[model samples]
Target: MGVFEVKGGRELKGEITPQGAKNEALQVLNAVLLTPEKVTISNIPNIRDVNKLIDLLKSLGVKIEQLNDDTYTFQADEIDIEYLTTPEFKEKGGGLRGSIMIVGPLLARFGKGYIPKPGGDKIGRRRLDTHFEGLQKLGANFEYDSNTNFYKTEAAKLKGTYMLLDEASVTGTANIVMAASMAKGKTTIYNAACEPYLQQLCNMLVNMGAKISGIGSNLLTIEGVKELHGTEHRCLPDMIEIGSFIGMAAMTNSEITIKDVHYDQLGMIPQVFSRLGITIVRRDDDLIIPKQNHYEIDQFIDGSILTVSDAPWPGFTPDLLSIVLVVATQAKGSVLVHQKMFESRLFFVDKLIDMGAQIILCDPHRATVIGLDKQVPLRGISMTSPDIRAGVALLIAALSAEGTSHIHNIEQIDRGYQYIDKRLQALGARIKRID
Candidate 1:
């Protein structure tokens, strides 16, 4: 609903701190709903989606108090169960994809979970079958209302059992793990998602007295406890934002230091970017990208064009593919960006093409970007953000462009990033938010 008027070709140089992991915050905030005691969390990003989830929790009668600028305590001692059946609950909860996570904590604590069909970026087919099917495996009766697209679950007693997930679905795995934490018996989950977000969730559960093992492995074993307690947890820094900053630095020929990246949890993200010929150096915990006059894509050992694709854990995240693709435009070589997870994310290349970048959209899943080698500067043009990751990619493109650029529908950008314009301004980039 707003626009960013950005003056392109500014070489930003400064230290920018990454916000707390948005994905992890979504799961962790919902975990507070599992206990009646006060749960305090720090480093929460002040973004739209997170604020909406907090609002949704508040509407359910969860007592929330702000402890600091980026810290809060939540107490879900008295939830209004009757509100779950209301139209407002369905409409408001459905607006956020993270809201589906509330179902897990609700089911564990209250023995009933009512969830509206959640909404998120329209990147690809993000099915909720993993969530419902995993919950059903834990002895919950699943019922779906076709007209309303609401999922209602109930259980007299949730008894745990061994189960193998269809995939390592992050949210699905988190949901099932939360449900199993309060079940009657031991639960063993194979093919679980072991992302840092899930590990942090498991650690938080353990802090709250839930018995869980295999913290960073796909196979996990959980022994259900009778109850959970309040705990304090801190979220890891946002890796996606750090990766975006690396891409932004490369495209604009800028030197930047991404501070306190939690390098251990990054898990091959830096290496993946290095594969694109971007010069990256690590100074203690921070990742530094120096301004490069020219960088070339690396070929495979067998002498084939490099393919950048996303995989499960221990692989490059699918979320950063857009940034990777955009930064490749100004590099010194050609690389194929294979967006294996989402089909529609690659469609944003048309906007970059209009900006004079030579990119070939091979299909919905693949695009070959021939780097300009900084020979011709991209011209800034008007564009609308299609999704969160693509929006940042466009912002990076606009910053590297030759003239002023106007980016509309910047709300998509705001949903994921926290005070992005102010942060850019601090880095000496000229960007104004037009309301």
Candidate 2:
């Protein structure tokens, strides 16, 4: 396992650029399988999970050419569809949660798609029922093999229809939309996930000749087309990373600037951090977070304790709740972080507690953080990263603490963050990668 040796108590400086969206890359990269034509994508993050997916595509015989470090052109003109039945495919497919997305496009074009049970962060139970059930409603046959732990879907000709989703799942919505794009008639999806990443996917599909309406709303309408062509796309700056940077600057009492972030798309993120008493000055597309020795949490309008909670898009993202929780440890007031989507995400608070943060784990879903207000500084210790989000959160904590910290299982962090230690080191942070 990889480890990050981070020395604490130094304030970071200089400007940092957020990488391309990891979530959007996963969705759009799979969308390349929807067409046989060439799809060129720019600003793709060179992270472990995305690279693993690219390798998986290569294994499926998708002709891929690397244009640069963060760009690729893929053409699925000749796919080895039968390779999905191989043990090698199972092992590769099971390693990535984004692997499930290939099923929708494959089933639409090739009549069949197979995948092993997908794996990702062990934060909580992420059900595949949303993906399968949504595809099943679009006239695909869904089957699960208990003995083999594999999922299979097939459709000769999918006929579009209206369906209401049980939840606004981002990946689920993207999967069903890809399948529906080539179906027989109009498909109406209510309660779809309308995140900016999903919107980017829809826009890319539309550019490729897919008839999609309601690009940025909960309700989407797709008119089936016989085929989709290819188009060039550039992913937006990662909003989660942008949020993490904001929290990190405040935690370490540093002045930093985040560049080229699509400000309009980052709904509620800046406001939420500002509620934690962080100053975010928007200059053009850049966000300048000035240094502050003490930032306080804001109370509610009724003078109640502030509560930071995660909701679906158009709300604060759950991915940054861990960052917010860690930042609040140094604020002047308390805030309750309610992680509604994942049960096990809050479990990482115990590690923060060990570093002397005043946090109360109310349950599996919520944490109450009482700010030390810099009256007491956290002393660093060795810890293990549990998942991608939590790993970065812990890294932010360690950067602001008083002593050195060793973080094990940093592969979890590398899976999402691209050259994070190097990036931090550029900002005067003393971080080293121990391979």
TM-score of 1: 0.99
Give the runs in model 2 whose Cα sits over 4 Å from its true position: none
Residue lDDT tens for model 1, 4-32: 99999989999999999999999999999
Q: What is the C-alpha lDDT of each candidate?
A: 0.93, 0.95
lDDT over C-alpha atoms for residue 43 of model 2: 98
TM-scores, all candidates, are 0.99, 0.99
Structure candidate 1, residue pairs in collision: none
After superposition, the stretches of candidate 1 with alpha carbons farther than 4 Å from their true spots are: none
Choose the strongest candidate by lDDT: 2
